[model samples]
Target chain A: MSLLRVENISKSFKTLQVLRDVSLEVNPGERHVIIGPNGAGKTTLFHCITNILPIDSGAVYLDGKEISKLPAHHLAHLGMSRTFQKNNLFGDLTVEENIHLALAAKKPYRYDIFSPLISRTDIRKETNDILEQWEISNRRHVKVKHLSYGEQRLLEVLLAMASNPKILLLDEPTSGMSPAETAQTSEMIQKLPRSVALVVVEHDMDVVFAIADRITVLHHGEVILSGSPDEVRNNEVVKEIYFGGGAKKHA
Target chain B: MKKLLLGVVLLIALVFAMPLVLSDFGINLATEIYIMAIFAMSLGLIMGYAGMVSLGHAGFFGIGAYTVAVIGQHVANTYLLLLLSVVISGLIALVTGAVFIRTSKFYFLMITLAFGQLLYVLFWQLKPWTGGADGMSVSAILNFGFGEIVSPNGFYYVMGIAFIIFYILLRLFVESPAGKITKGIMENEARMSALGYNVRVYKLLAYTLSGALAGLAGALYAYFNVFVSPDLSGWMFSGQVMVMVIIGGVGTLLGPALGASVFIYLQNFMSTYTERWPMVMGALLVALVLAGKGGLIHWLQHGKSLFVARKRTGEAVSQQPVKKGEAVH
Candidate 1:
C-alpha cells in the first residue's frame, strides 16, 4: 500500500506555473527517484509535497489522511521531513547540536523558557547515533559552517535522518560532489533503513540507477513518465529531454 | 566546572560588595546598569537567537513601568502588582508579535516601531489614567503582608537578583535545542521552514518572551524610581536597547550585560555635564558598528583568547571545515 499519495498537485508563483498536475505515490519503504533536467520543477515538486510552498491545487494523503493543507511543522509531526536542494544546516551550531535539534523537533515543545537541552540524554544519544552512522562522529563538535562541502551534504542527510520521519524528501542530495564523494553518498543512501519511504530528486543518472526502486520523470512541472527504473531508462520522451536524445549512443 | 563555579562566586561577591565600595551616586549608577542589562538581554533574545530585528522594545518597558506604578497606586501588595504588570506586558507582546512576526525583516522592524509608537501615543492621550505626557508616580511600594518593601537600595538588590536569574535562564535557553532551532531560524529560515519547523511561530514566541523580559525590567524601574512617563515608551529608548545589544555582542548572554554597564555608566557620568550626550552616544555607536566587530564582550572572550595564545596551539581551530555544498561565505 502507498504510504504517501500526491494527486493533481499544481503550483504557480505569480504567472509562472512551477508544478502542473503532478501526481505520484510511494509505497512503504520504496526508494522513489525523481529525475529531470534543470528547471524541471523537481525542487518545486518537493516543496509542494513538503508543504513549504502552497499548492494551487492538489490532494496529499499520508496513510489515507489528507494532509495537503497542513503547515510544514504540523506535517513534521505527521511523520514527514525534507532536506533542501541547497545544503541547509544551522551554521553556527555544532554538528551534534544540529542533529539534537532535529531530534528535539520530533517531540513537541511549547516555547519552553529556561530549559537546557544539553541535559537531555535520549536526544543526545540519538544525535550521536545518526552522526556515527553518517561517519561524521569525528566532526561532531565542529560547527556546521566549517565542514567541507562533501561533509556538509552528508550532514544534511544525517539531519533528515535525525528527525526519524516516515517520509523523507531529499532534493539534489549529491549535486556538487566529487566522483568519490558521490559514490560515498550513494552508498549512504543505499544503506538507509527500509522502514522510511524516500522521494529523492537527483540530477545524477548513475546515482539514480544505483538506488531508485522506481523513477518519475518531470518536464516543465508535469510528470511525463513514471515506471520502473528500466522502463524510465528506455522511454523515448525521457531520452529526448534528459539524456540528450541520442538513445543509440547511450544504448 | 571549577572555573564556572569561580565565575559565579565572583559575580555574586561583586554584586554584594558594590555598595561598600561605591558612593551613593555610584550605587545608583550600578542599579541603572542592572536594569539596562535586563532590557538589553530582552533585545538579544530576538535579535541574536531568533534572527529578528525589533525596534519597539521600549514599548514593553513603558508598559511594564506603568503596570508597576499603576498597580502600586491601587493595589496593596507589591508582589501582586509586579506579577500583574509582567502578565499584561507579556500579553501585549504576544498580541503584537502574533501580527508583527508575520512580516519580513523591514516590515518586522516597521510594525514593531509602529505598534510601540501607538502604545506611546495611547499613554499620552489617556491623560487622567496614564497621566498623559506628565506620567504617573506612586508614593511607595506597598508590601502588604511583607510590610513596606520600598526603598531604592532595597529595590537595587531585588532588581539585581532578578537580572542575575533572568540572565542565567536566557543563557540556558540559548544553549538548548529549541534555542538551536532559533539560531537555525537566524541562519537559514527557509531551511527551517522546509524541515517542518514553523519559522514565524518560533520567531513570534521569541518576540513575546523578549517583550515579557523587557516588561520585567520596566516594572522594576518604575518601582525603583516611583515614576512612569511617556519618555519610558519612546522610540529613542528602544534604540538605546539596540545599541546596548550591539555593544555587548548580539548573541552572547554576557554581551548585553557588558554593553548595558558601559552605557548606563556613560549616561550617568556624562549626562551631568551636557545635553549633547545623545550626539556623543550616536557617534560612539556608529564607530563601534563600523569596526565590523561584535560587541566588546565577544571581542574580550574570543580576541583575548587569541591574543594570549597567538594561534599558537592550533587553538584557533574553528569547529569544522565549511560544508562543500553550502559555501560558508
Candidate 2:
C-alpha cells in the first residue's frame, strides 16, 4: 500500500482554482519529487496533503486510511510530517531547544507540567544524539536567529525528520540556498534513510534530478506526469514545458 | 533556576523580617502587594509564555473575590471557599478561552476587555449577591482549623507563603514540556502546530490555569481587604496588573511578581507625599518604556549602570584616529 496517497484532491482560493484533480502516491521508501514552475500550485498541493489547508473535494489517505478530515496537527502522529516552503523556525529558541520541541511533541507525557524538561534525560539524550549525528552539536546552544539562512533551512528539515514520520514532505527545502549549499542539501537529501518516503516540492532542477527516484511534473494546478526519472527526462511535453525547448535551464 | 531559588529564599526572609520592622499599616500594604503579585504573575504566564495578552485578567481575579465575598456568606470553611473560587474561575476561563483563544493579537485584547467589563457589570448589578457597586464585606472568617487569621501579620505570612508556592509552581511549569511548548507557541505557533502539538489546546490550558491562579489571588485579596467590589473586575484594575507585568519584565518567572511589589510599594510611597501619584506613575512608566531594558528586574540584573557606572573616555576601535584627510560620515 502507498504510504501516502492524495486522490483527486481539488482546492480553490476565492475565485481562483489552486489545485485541480491532483493525484499523487508514494510507496514506502519512495523518493518522490515534484517539480514545477512558480505558481504551479506545488506548495498548495503540499498544504492540502498535510491538511494545513482544507481540501475542497477529494480525500487524502495515509497508509490507506482516510486523513482528509483530520486536523493538521494530528497528521504528525499519523506519520505524516512536512516543512514549509518559507522558514517556519522558532527564531528565539536555541537550536537544541527547537529540536527538543519537535522530538518532545511525539512523546506521550509532554503535557506533564510537574516534571521539568531538563530532568527528562531520555529526551535530552535523543536531542544530543540527533544534533551530534547532524554534525551541528557545536552550534546547538546558538539561538536559531543567529544561524545562517542555509543552516536554518537545514534545521527545518531536521525538525521535520525528528518525528520519524513514515512520509516526510519537504517544500522547497533549498529555496534560498547558494549553489554550494544547494548541492550540499541535495547530497544530504539523497542520503536520507529509505525507511522514510520523501515527497519534495522543488524548483532546483539539479536537486530534483539528483534525489528523485521518480518525478511528478506539475503545471497550472494539474499533474503533467508522474513517472520514473528516465521517463520524465525523455517525455516530449515535460521537456518543452520544464526545460523550455531544448536548452536545459532551471524552471 | 538558581536565581529563582534565591528569590524564594529572599521572599521568605522578607516575610519573617518585614512585620518586625514595619507598622500595622505597612504590614497591610505589604500583604496586598503579595496578593497582587500573584495576580500579576498569572497574567504574566499567558502574556510571556503563552503569547496571550489579555486585558480581562481582572475578571478572573474579580470572580475569585466575589466567590469568596458572596459564597463565603454561607460556607465558612476557608479551604472549601478557596477551592470553589479557583474551580469556578477556571471553569469560566475554560469556556471563555475557547472563544477568546480563537482570536489573536488585538482582537484578543479587545475581546478580553469586553469580557472583563461584562463581569464588572454582572458584579455591579447583582446587588443582593455582590452587595452592588459599593461592594460587600467578606462575612466569613478565614479559619484554617487552628484559629481565625484576623491579625495583619498573620495574613501577611499566609499571603507570603501563597506567593512563594505559586512562584515555584510557575517555575516548575515553565521548565516543563507543556510550558516549553507554550513558550514555543509564543515564538512560533506554526512550527509547534506542524510538529504535531495542538496549539489551541495548549493555549486554552495556559489561559485556564492563569485564570485559576488569578482567582486564587483575588480570593486572598478579599480576605485581606474584607471587601469585594466591581472595580476588582474593572478594566482599570486589569490594566494595572498589566502595568505591573511590564514593570517587572514579561518572560521571567520572578519579573511580574517583582514588578507587582515595586508598583505597589511605589504607589504607597509616592502617595504619602503627593496627591498626584498617578502623574508620577505615568512618568515612571514612560521612562521604563523608553529605557526598554526588558523591565526593572532585567535592568537591576545588568550591572545597575544607571546609578553606579562612571563614564569612561576611550578611543573607539572603529574610529580611525582622525586620519589626516579622512571624512567622517
Candidate 3:
C-alpha cells in the first residue's frame, strides 16, 4: 500500500508556476527519487508535500488520510519528516544537544519545563546511540558551527531520522559534498531502516540511480516520466530533457 | 554543579548577613536590584531562549505592578496580591503572545514595543484606578496574618527569598527539556518545526512564562518602592531590562541577574559622581560592547578559565606528563 500519495499537487510563486499538476506515490519501504534539472519545481513539490508551501490545487495523502491542508509541524507529527536543501541545524548547540532536542520532539513531555532533561536516562541513552550510529560521537560536544560542511549535511539527515518518521523527504542531501562524502552519504541513506519510506529530490544522477527503487523524472513543473531506473533510462522524452538529444545510451 | 551549589550557598549567606553591615539605603538598593534581576531574567527566557525579541516586556511588568496596587487597596495580603498579579500578567501575555509569536524578528520587536507603549498610555489615562501620571502609593504588605512588613530589612529579606526561589525555578526551567527545545528554536525555528515541534506553542509558553516572572518582579517592586506609576510600563523600562539581559549575557541562566546587579550598581555609582549619568552609562555600555560579545558574564567566565589554565600549568608540568598528553588531544 502507498504510504505517501501526492495527487496532482500544484504550487506557484507569483507569476511563476513552479509545480503544475505534479503527482506521485510511494509504496511502503520504497526509495522514490525525484530527479530534475534546475527550475523543474522538484523542491517546490517537496515543499507542497510537506505543507511548507500551500498548494494551488490538488491534495496530498499520508497513510490514506488527506493531509493537504495540515501545517508542516502537524505533518511531522503524523509521521512525515523532511530535510532542507541547505543545512538546517541548531548551529549554536552542541552535536549531542542537537540530537537530544530531536529525540525530545516525539517524546511525551516535550514541553515539560520542570523536569531536568539530563535526568531522563532513556533519552540520554537514545541520543548517545544515535550519535554513535551516525559516527559523530567524537564531535558530540562540539558546537555545530565548528562542524565541516559534510558533517553538517550528515547531521541534518541524522536529525530528520531522529524523529523516527514513517516517511522521510530529503532534498539535495548530498549537495555541495566531495565525491567521497557523497559516497558516504549515499551509503548512509542506503542503510536507513526498511520500514521508513524515502522521497529524495536530487540533481546527482549517480546518487539517484544508486539508491532509488523507483525514479520519477520532472521537467518544467511536471512529471515527465515515472518508472524503474532502467525504464527511465530508456525513455525518449527523459533522454531529450536530461541528456540533450536522441543520442543512444546504454540502459 | 558543585560550584553552582557553593555559589548559591555563599550568596544566601551573604544576603542573610547584609543588614549587619550595610545601611538602610544599601538594603533598599539591594531590594531594587533583586526586583530588576527577576525582570531581566524573564526577558532572557523569551529573548535568549525562544529568540522572540519582545520590546514590550515592561507592559507585563506594569500590569503586575498595577495589579498589586489596585488589589492592595482592598486586599492587604501580600501573597494574594502577588498571586493575582502573576495570573493577570500571564493572561495578558497569553492573549498578546498568540498574536506576537506569529511575527518574526523586527516585526516582533516593533509590535511588542507598541504593546508596551499602549499599556503606558492606558496607565496614564486610567487616572481613577492607576492614579495616572502622578502615580499611586502602594499599601503596606501584610505578612499572611502577621503585622505589616514596612521596614526596609523586612522587605529586603522578603525580596531576597523570592529572588532565590525564582532564580532556582528559572534555572531548572532552562535546564529542562522544554528549555532545550526553546534554545533549539532560537538557533533554528524551521528545523524544530520540521522535527514535529509546534514552534508557536513553545514560543507562546516562553512568552507567557516570561510575562509571569516579570509580573512577579513588578509586584515586588510595587511593595518595595510603595509606588506604582505609568513609567513602569514604558518602553524605557523594557529597554533597560533588555540592556540588563545583554550586559549580563544573553543565554546563561544567571546572566540576567548579574547584569541587573551590574547595571544598578553602575547607575548608582555614576549618579553619585556626575549628574549626566546617562551619558556615562552609555559610554560604559559602548566600552562593554567594544570589549567583546556575550557581555560581562562571558568575560568573567573567560577570565576564570584563563586563570585556571595558568594555575594548572604552574602545578602540573612535571607531576603529570601522561595527563598533559591526554590534554593535548
User: lDDT of each structure?
Assistant: 0.81, 0.90, 0.87
Instruction: Please provide, for model 3 over B135-182, each residue's C-alpha lDDT reduced to its tens digit, 9 standing for 90 to 100.
Output: 999875748566778788888888888888888788788889998888
TM-score of chain A of 2: 0.96
Top model by lDDT, which number?
2
Ranking by DockQ: 3, 2, 1
Docking class of 1: acceptable
Poorly placed runs, candidate 3 (over 4 Å): A245-251, B1-4, B142-146, B311-329
DockQ for each numbered candidate:
0.41, 0.45, 0.62
The sequence of per-residue lDDT tens digits that candidate 2 reaches over residues B1-329 is 66567877987887789888999888888899999999999999999999999999999999999999999989999999999999999999999999999999999999999999999999999998887889999898888898999998889899988988998999889989999999998988877888999999999999999999999999999998898899999999999999999999998867898899889999999999999998988899899989886898787766554443232214335455434322110
Ranking by lDDT: 2, 3, 1
By TM-score: ranked, best first: 3, 2, 1
Candidate 2 ranges with C-alpha deviation above 4 Å: A243-251, B1-3, B304-329
| Candidate 3: residue pairs that collide | none
Cα deviation at B42, candidate 3, in Å, is 1.0
Stretches of candidate 1 exceeding 4 Å from the true structure: A108-111, A243-251, B1-6, B142-152, B307-329
Better of 1 and 2 by DockQ: 2
Candidates' chain B TM-scores in the order shown: 0.89, 0.90, 0.93
